[model samples]
Target chain A: AQRVTQPEKLLSVFKGAPVELKCNYSYSGSPELFWYVQYSRQRLQLLLRHISRESIKGFTADLNKGETSFHLKKPFAQEEDSAMYYCALKKAGSARQLTFGSGTQLTVLP
Target chain B: NAGVTQTPKFRVLKTGQSMTLLCAQDMNHEYMYWYRQDPGMGLRLIHYSVGEGTTAKGEVPDGYNVSRLKKQNFLLGLESAAPSQTSVYFCASSLRGTSGVAGELFFGEGSRLTVL
Candidate 1:
């Protein structure tokens, strides 16, 4: 079975501090992982995909095959970055269904 | 363009009552999915459709039915509401890819259902 786990339910960090949201997955086939964020009163949207390897809004995530993890990181946190973040994995098949983790609520305190 | 739209953004139903949640996407996506968001449970896939007239159950499908009579629309129906069924439902769509799996999904604002 394929599963995504976000161990932290809530993470708080002060502005300008570094931030890391851990995400781990268990899958038999190659994995395709993504981070999604939802701001207040906003619909959930894609933050970044491991395949892209590109940073979005100063946040980056590298897929670690050895650890089976795709942790999202940011050099400096911002108050605007506070939101609910979810880690999702695309199943390795034609179904293309997304399996999401429980989610992490990040709070950037000033 | 309305990427994805869900009707009845909010609804309340008594237990044992039936209701249907409609999801429509204007992106002409080939795939549509229904998911329910619960506290600390993340989003669980209830059902999905790859194309018109095709439907498949996902991680959680009990007490739910879906239909894709039209390519751009997918409907999720509940035969009888229950307190456990109360949740925020989200509809998402994605374009088909040559790689066999669909791409990034576009989601709607969501529909909050309260079961009494």
Candidate 2:
């Protein structure tokens, strides 16, 4: 069975501090992973994908194949970066479907 | 463009009541999906449609039915509402891609439903 797990329910950090949101997955075949963010009163949107390997809003997630982990990280946390973040994985097929993990609510304190 | 839109942004229903949530995407995407958002569960797939008439059960599909009569629309129906079914539903769409190439899923604003 393919599963995505985001261990943290809530993560608190102060502004200018480093941040890390852990995500792990279980899949037999090679998997595709992505991070989605939901801001206040906003729709859940794509933040970054492991494929691109490019940082978005100063956030980066590297897919660790050996550990099946794709942890999201930021050098300096910003207050505005606080929001609900979800990790998702796609099953391979003609009609791809996403399997999302429990979200992490990051609250950047002043 | 309203990329993806869900109707009835807010709803309240009693137990055993039935309701349908509609999701429409204007991106001409071939894939549409329905998911439920809970406090800690993030989002769980309920159902998905590949094209105009093809539908498939997702990770969690009990007590829910989906229809894709039109190319750009996918509808999720709850035959009988339950307290457990009370959640925020989200609809998403994505373009066709294979294996590792499939990128992001565009999501809607979400529809909050409460079952009393």
Candidate 3:
């Protein structure tokens, strides 16, 4: 069984402040991790993937195999960054589906 | 391109009534998935298909049925509507990859369903 957990249901931060959304997963096999964002009145889109090792919209996540975590981080929060963030995991084999976390509602206050 | 499109953006059904949500992708993706989003539960996979004429159960498959009769269309059916089934439904598609590596998912705007 594969499970992803986002501990915070809601998080708020002032503009320009650093922000972090925690995510942890439990999967017996090797995993691929990704972050998806849903903006207001918009469809969900991929923010970043661990395999890419790149940042999107100033957000980055490092997969920690030892800790079983893949936390999303941003150097500075912006009002436009306010949205629902979901952490997802995909097993490394034939099962090509994603298991998503509960999600974190990020609110960047101006 | 329309990417992934889900019909009936908003729907309301009475308890015990049945309805089907349609998803169509124009990108010729090999993988299609149906997910339900709730206030606190995030998105749970209802069902998915790896290719045409193939469907599989997902994380939350109970009370929902799906079909992938064609390569570009996936349908999700609710046999009997219930209040607990009310949520926003999303349809996504991704290209098939070799060696289990997955492609980025493209999603539809979503269909909002409410069971009264």
Top TM-score hit: 1
Writing each residue's lDDT as its tens digit, candidate 1 over B58-77 gives: 99999999999999899999
Instruction: Provide C-alpha RMSD values for all models, in order.
Output: 1.5, 1.5, 1.5
Per-residue lDDT over A1-110 for candidate 1, one digit per residue giving the tens place of the 0 to 100 score: 89999999999999999999999999989878999999999999999888788899999999999999999999999999999999999876556689999999999999
Top-lDDT structure, candidate number = 1
**lDDT of each residue in B1-116, candidate 3, tens digit only:** 99999998999999999999999999999999999999888889999999999999998999999999999999999999999999999999998874333558899999999999
**TM-score (2 decimals) of chain A in model 2:** 0.97
- Each candidate's fnat, listed in order, reads 0.69, 0.87, 0.67
Q: Looking at model 3 chain A, which ten-residue stretch has the lowest summed lDDT?
A: A90-99
- Model 3: residues with Cα > 4 Å off, grouped in runs: B98-101
- DockQ for each model: 0.81, 0.84, 0.76
Give the TM-score of each candidate: 0.97, 0.96, 0.96
Per-residue lDDT of candidate 2, residues A1-110 (tens digit) = 88999999999999999999999999999888899999999989889988788899999999999999999999999999999999988765536688889999999999
**Reference contact recovery of candidate 1:** 0.69
Chain A TM-score (model 1): 0.97
What DockQ does candidate 3 have relative to the true complex? Answer: 0.76
Superposed Cα deviation of residue B26, candidate 3 (Å): 0.2
lDDT of 3 by residue, A1-110 (tens): 88999999999999999999999999998898999999999999999999988999999999999999999999999999999999998887654688889999999999
Question: RMSD to the native, candidate 3?
Answer: 1.5
**Collision count of model 3:** 0
